[model samples]
Target: MTDGSIQQTRLPTRTVVLHIGRHKTGSSSIQATLRHNQAQLLQRGVLVPKNLPPNLSGFFSHVFSRAPEALKFNVERGHGRQQAQKHGNRLLERLAHELEAFTGNRIVLSGEEACALHPDEVAQVRDRLGPVLAPAGQQVDFRVLLYTRDPVAYASSAMQQNIKKNVKLLEDHKPVVLRKAPGWYQRTHAAWAGVFGADAVEFRSFETACAAPGGLIGDFLTAAGIPPEGIEPQRANDSIADEIAGFLSSSHVPKLPPDQRGLWSAGFDLSTADQEILFAIRGSKGGLLTASEQAGLWDAVAADMRFIEREFGITYGAAQTAGAVPFGPVFMDDLKAALPRLSPPVRRGLLAYLRDRSAPGDPGQLQPEGI
Candidate 1:
């Protein structure tokens, strides 16, 4: 689908819904739901692309066009700016073609990476599509949906994912995350609003949406103007269990050099019993936030949360301002009960780690804001 193949044909009037993500907000789940219900949605006059990248879970999957430079080069096959823009223009052409042929009243194009697009890139998107969707008697609306989460929770989840990707412990990489954490949720949404009219932007709290009647998927369908009846929600990208998360946070497995880490993980084995024990400890541990740390992070994002609530007319669990307190010292009784399942080395490591981390940290130590 090159730029040359697409003609500058005017598309029929329709509602364009763009889901720009603040990541770690269950965008994956939403995308999966959208894919699963593509047929039903089309039947209901909501057209969506049938061939989105399943692996990336993105509506459009050209790395050069969709990702930022640093991410594109480091994570994907590196391409120059000219190449990216060229490819992006091609994608817009395809999008225009799809819209031109679409008979539906609504068309949805969802991609989390779109949230990272520069203003100019966004302008390119609008300009490229604007001609294709010019007013045609029927109303033409361009709307963007953005889902936000609490800063601490989002960061904690992002940290978990980052560690999973690279061979790095939480401590080794957390400093960078805390220092450059994405606290600009408000700014990001504002950028989209500026480009696509304030009235055109739809802001929703991921937490609140997840807690809604049908959970995240249900709430997203409702937001997408899809009826939720008969839709079976499937959870995607499930997080590692809390105790295992804690172990991974402290362990050097992911922190090993790339080669060694791969080999270690490949050869490493865990018993069914140990796996069960670890799974049992799920929800026992959360983000490494002390009572004070949680409160501080919450306060830092208080303004952002307030802005979202005021602008979107929705509450994002205001009552739950603080994250759960960090786990207290390991209970010897519980530890003893679980010792039979763990390998000797793991058992010893857990004992030492727990013993050493029993005491509360120094209150004077610097902590990242809004993390």
Candidate 2:
């Protein structure tokens, strides 16, 4: 019944889904799913571009390529909106050109870093995207999906991640307490929704998403109105064991020289044994949660749950009722399984690699003659 060119029919000229990630959630899982399902999406008359590159590098490259002045202030003064209008215009042009060249059915550009933009930046983004999508005779629908978790749990998990990446936060010095202040979600989501309208913004709890029987990917697909079946489940990035070790080694424990510390205070490429050591260290340091603290944290999380539901108008209990699963058990199993496979030499080599990578200047300078 529809009469349109194959280009128009196969490709959605107007609508583009921009998944702006609110970090420490299941953003990785969503990105992985999209990457894995690129072909399947195309078959469904959707195009998720693999050539879009990863993270802010490619995005900034595309933006700065057209407007070189955009990065000048951002790099020098750490101010992002130095040349907002020019940058926005250039970005729109680049995206339009790329979309036109793509032969696939639908075009999906995803980057978690996009969530870092301010309100003004988001407006700029919308303005840029509008022109790019207009030429294709497609209506642009900007969908902002954010996954929130219990603040206590999120902080703990995030600390672990920071240790792995060797990042240190000022709050690491403060006692771990559940504060009820507005967080990244409030700032970032509110900004985008202000520009894009509340209906276009969807927020889900990461805890619920990962709890599903089919895991994070299934939950996201269901939310996005995409069929979950037959999509390959790629391994989620940033292992939990590494995350724990990174946290303990970085923030909870005494500080080390920058070179010795993990990038995010989350150590990289940690094995199962490393996680066990980390847990043991935490126990020794009285860092393991007391039963009462755990209960209190959960209570705080419950409060956050209520808040998100009221604010975002989304449901979180569905996946929980359907036999919700916890990630701790899976993490423990992975650590245990990895132990026997790591010989002493391999462990030493890994340590050296981590140190060398984290070290300043050329790590080769510190390397032994034989190495």
Candidate 3:
């Protein structure tokens, strides 16, 4: 009986879903899913632009292209946002043309680094999209979606990631210096709300979203107004096991490229007992924060947790009350139990490491090179 039932209907409405990530919040999985399901999304009248980089996080650099002053000096030097904007603008213009031609109702773009931009820089993004989208006779709905994580957990994970990338946090004795203390979520949320209007900005807890029926991928699909019934939620850029991550993060270990490092993670065929050791190591919180720092971090983020609970209607379990030593008796027990199954050099290293720990005043003894 509807008009579309008798004849083909050109979708007139278009929605722009902007996903700004606070990093380490499963943004990769969501991006990978969107990239993988582009065809399906198109069929459903959703346009996930093919012109954008395969990893949508690359779009963050594009947003930053015109706002060089806003980029923090320490981290933004190499992102090449200025040069990238030229390429991105061309894509955006092309996307505008495509949006006019395509019979789709939705467009999705995502980037974690976009959340790093100041409010003024984010306004530039809105300015770019405005003229293009405004020309459409149909209504334009622009929305911003942000996934927020527990500050303590986010900081711990980010620290581990930095170390994995060979930042030498431990070696430099400045591991926690760069990490923002608490209130980051509030500040960032305010900025986004200010730019997009309060109603247009939606906040979703990363923990809750990831734990939803279809995990992060499904959660994001649902958020983008797409159905999640038949999609696979594959994790991308998965973190390595704690023991493996620990080994790579050790001060003396040489840094390897990400792909090569991933190979190391894949190559380890851990047994059940070995898994127990790895689990214990992981439980140690990536060995990144000292106990006092960990406790204080939770305390600092407590207010944000309350705000998240009240504002987002999501409540998480209380943060850990105390910090744990990076390695513990469980690690030692599992390591000892699994030693015979390990390779010769690894066995030698583990044995030597244990021996050195037991003897006092033996700081530099038998620290195996190829562990």
Candidate 4:
């Protein structure tokens, strides 16, 4: 049946939860779970809007982005400001329509890109979106949820993610991540808290949340006022394997910069077996930032680490030295086993990468296995 034909409905006062992500912090996992469990969530009076994708970054960015032309979404569409403005207007209709049809008493909107919105833009979101989303004669409470991790770790993982998606990030010839971790956190905190009121903002440690009872999804559900019962947890957007990241750090680039970078294509191929091997090595590497870089990251972010502790009541523990550790044995063993199975193209690429690494920080390089 058509949406128009379906009976329109109204519900009680709603809490519109906006989970703004500070990326690399399990946002993908939460979005995936919510997207896949839409029907189940709706049954319990939570609307994960059908009109929109699970990640609302595109939606949010179009509305608040100061530079629409630079947005990956708009750039991909060949959309300049005029087109982006037109697109944002189109989203409003969809937003209103979704809210008009929503029977649930709560809404959960997520987008990692929203983490960077300015305070004024956040208020713009409130002013513009609140009325369209509120059910008739019911109050709409806006709550912002943000999950953060240790500065060093967050940057390390984020850098690896950049390289995985866009090999060309290597062009900068700088540290894969810059020393901006501290400012990144403070800005995100200010953007949300400055408008929403500190009381309306919820901050959780990503590592802690993932380690808790039902893991990240469960923790998020509880934070969003949903019962965790019977909702299966999810995992998504696994970072490139540690060994792979380490390999890239040494072999491909002169330097890896923390600033944003991307690519249109990888210029390489990964067959099913190669893809499987990539999946298998995910947790086995870390400390992608070299020793000097890791220390610099911590030094830069240390003051804010204390600020976050005092202000948000969050604390990050010690981090490992960069470039000192070998990619985990698990990565070594798994790749050793999977090497024979990789497609010739991927196998050749791996062998070439292994042969040309510029540094010797890792002792467990696959040459030991005679690949």
Could you tell me the lDDT of residue 263 within candidate 2? 33
The lDDT leader among the candidates is 4
Expressed as tens digits, the lDDT of each residue in 1-371 for candidate 3 is 68876354433557889888868888888888788888887888777777676556555555444554334431345435555556566667766776676676688888888877778777777777765754545557888888887665676667556544444333342345334657777777777788878888888888787778677777888887888976666677655334444554442233345565342232333344543443334224433555677676767777777777787786665445332333445554555555566655555544544443333443433244311
Candidate 4 clash total? 9
Per-residue lDDT over 193-267 for candidate 4, one digit per residue giving the tens place of the 0 to 100 score: 888788898888898888887888988999999999989877888887655755444433233244432345433
Task: Point out the higher-scoring one by lDDT: 1 or 3.
Answer: 3
For candidate 1, the TM-score is 0.72
Q: Considering lDDT, which of the candidate structures 1 and 2 is the better prediction for this target?
A: 1
Per-prediction TM-score: 0.72, 0.61, 0.72, 0.85
Per-residue C-alpha lDDT of model 2 across residues 1-371, encoded as one tens digit per residue:
44666455653545556666656676776777787878787787666655554343336333523344454334554435555545545555655665675554334566666776767767866775666654555556666666766554455555455444445442451233345323555676688899999888888767677878978878777776567888887756553443244334432333446687543342233455554444432211112233455455555556445657788654433111111112234443543444355556444543453343332433343234422
Better of 2 and 3 by TM-score: 3
* Residue ranges of candidate 4 with Cα displaced over 4 Å: 1-12, 167-176, 248-276, 355-371
What is the lDDT, from 0 to 100, of the residue 181 in candidate 1?
44
Which stretches in model 3 have alpha-carbon errors above 4 Å? 1-11, 64-85, 97-100, 133-135, 167-179, 254-287, 316-318, 321-371
Candidate with more favorable, higher TM-score: 1 or 2: 1
lDDT of each: 0.61, 0.54, 0.63, 0.74
Global Cα lDDT for candidate 4: 0.74
